[model samples]
Target: MQRVVEEISLKAWPAFETINHRGWLMRFANGYTKRANSVTVLDEIGLDIEEKITYCESQYRARKQNPIFCLLSFTNPEVLDERLATRGYQLIEPSLVMGITLSERSLNILPIINQETLNDWLVAYHKLKALAEQPSSTHHMILAGIQSEILFVSFKQNEEIVACGIGVLESGCLGIFDLVTSPMQRRRGYATAIIQGLLQWGIDKGAYFSYIQVVKANIPACNLYEKLGYEPIYEYWYRVGSNSGNEK
Candidate 1:
């Protein structure tokens, strides 16, 4: 059902390297993020399911990275999920893939968008999450590899970046990623403003649909997306490989 836009969605997220093992798709993006470094499109084609799974596992192991299977709700064979569960793979980040038709969306607010603002987003993301002092090189790679039309938006207060987000467009399907606001700026509608700016940017560029992935545990983000008319038509989770899979 969502396959049409899903293909475009997948294309928008260009991985650095991809391998096909008998119709299964595995992507590697320097292990910066899970979605870009996971196995998906587990099609029941030439190889048996177990064989495909084994190949996926071996490939990641050879690369010295843990394998992650993205299990989608509408997956064919219906039993794929069960097979993964039986293999000691733990389910993680049961996330909602919310999307909405963008034809009806409108916002009058302006966004401060350009390549230069990426540093602002990086500062906000690192500070708000309280992550390590040094950032990963793969993050920069992932951001730099975006081939489609994109925009980096940031809002400032008192001359400091308070909120930031990014929008990407591919074949009329716009994807929003890495939307983060300063911890001190929460509940001030800064996040909402960023979302509105992103949406309007996409719409003005001829986008008619938008998609966002939010973890189910994020109540506030889910509520905000719902208010924007984005519904979770389907969900997916990562089948962690018991190794260094990004469980969250």
Candidate 2:
């Protein structure tokens, strides 16, 4: 189950470049989101774990990025995390993969709009969360790189967007991402409305399950998902080298 979710997630949130060394997949995306730029260890337990780590560090260093390793609870060679810690890597962003089985449910979708163009969505999103020119550009690249079916749903009030989220549908699962609500408009049920609508869309498309990745420290987000019937599926965290900055 972990492997399946990880595979779908990689496809849902793609990287600009991916290099598979031995077994680990090293991703790079101009230092955008850590998820897009970190190395992910799947099911391979190749020999020379130390050598592999050095190779990954070199690769990321060449790209001017701090080395980051994303370790899942079920990652192979179980000692990888300990080995990384011994090499001066610090743990960060302990997060959970939450999921729920989709079923029939009444949805109160707010006055939301489905963006037609990437620019349109970005414009509305910028209104909710400020993004500089460079990050805005990189975010656009990441979103445009997704090949699966996507939904850019935004909640509007008085003709202005107050909250927004993205739904990526693939392999009978809906992977939710980029859920953010305007600071002043939060706790107003906009997020709940958007989530209900997204889940309904997934069910309409024959999806059996829906999932989201949230940082453990985000209490409101964790609570929101719980109220929407999502449960913790697995935990993953990043191990950042001494030189790497924890961007995002």
Best-matching candidate per lDDT = 2
TM-score of each: 0.89, 0.91
Could you give candidate 2's per-residue lDDT for residues 1-248 as a string of tens digits? 87898899999999999999988899999988889999898886567988898889989988888899999887654688888888888899999999998875534443355553677778877777866543378889999999999998888888888888899999998999988899999999998878887888888888888999999999999999999899999899999884453322
CA shift at 144, candidate 1, in angstroms? Answer: 0.5
Looking at model 2, report the run of 10 residues with the lowest lDDT sum. Answer: 105-114
Q: Pick the candidate with the highest TM-score.
A: 2
- Give each prediction's root-mean-square deviation over alpha carbons: 3.3, 3.1
lDDT by residue for model 1 (57-134), tens: 888878888888887776663566677778877788988889988775456666554343566566666766668776
Instruction: Name the runs in model 1 displaced over 4 angstroms.
Output: 42-47, 104-106, 109-115, 243-248
Listed per model in order, the count of residue pairs whose N, CA or C atoms clash below 3 Å is 1, 0
Error of 1 at 35 (Å): 0.2
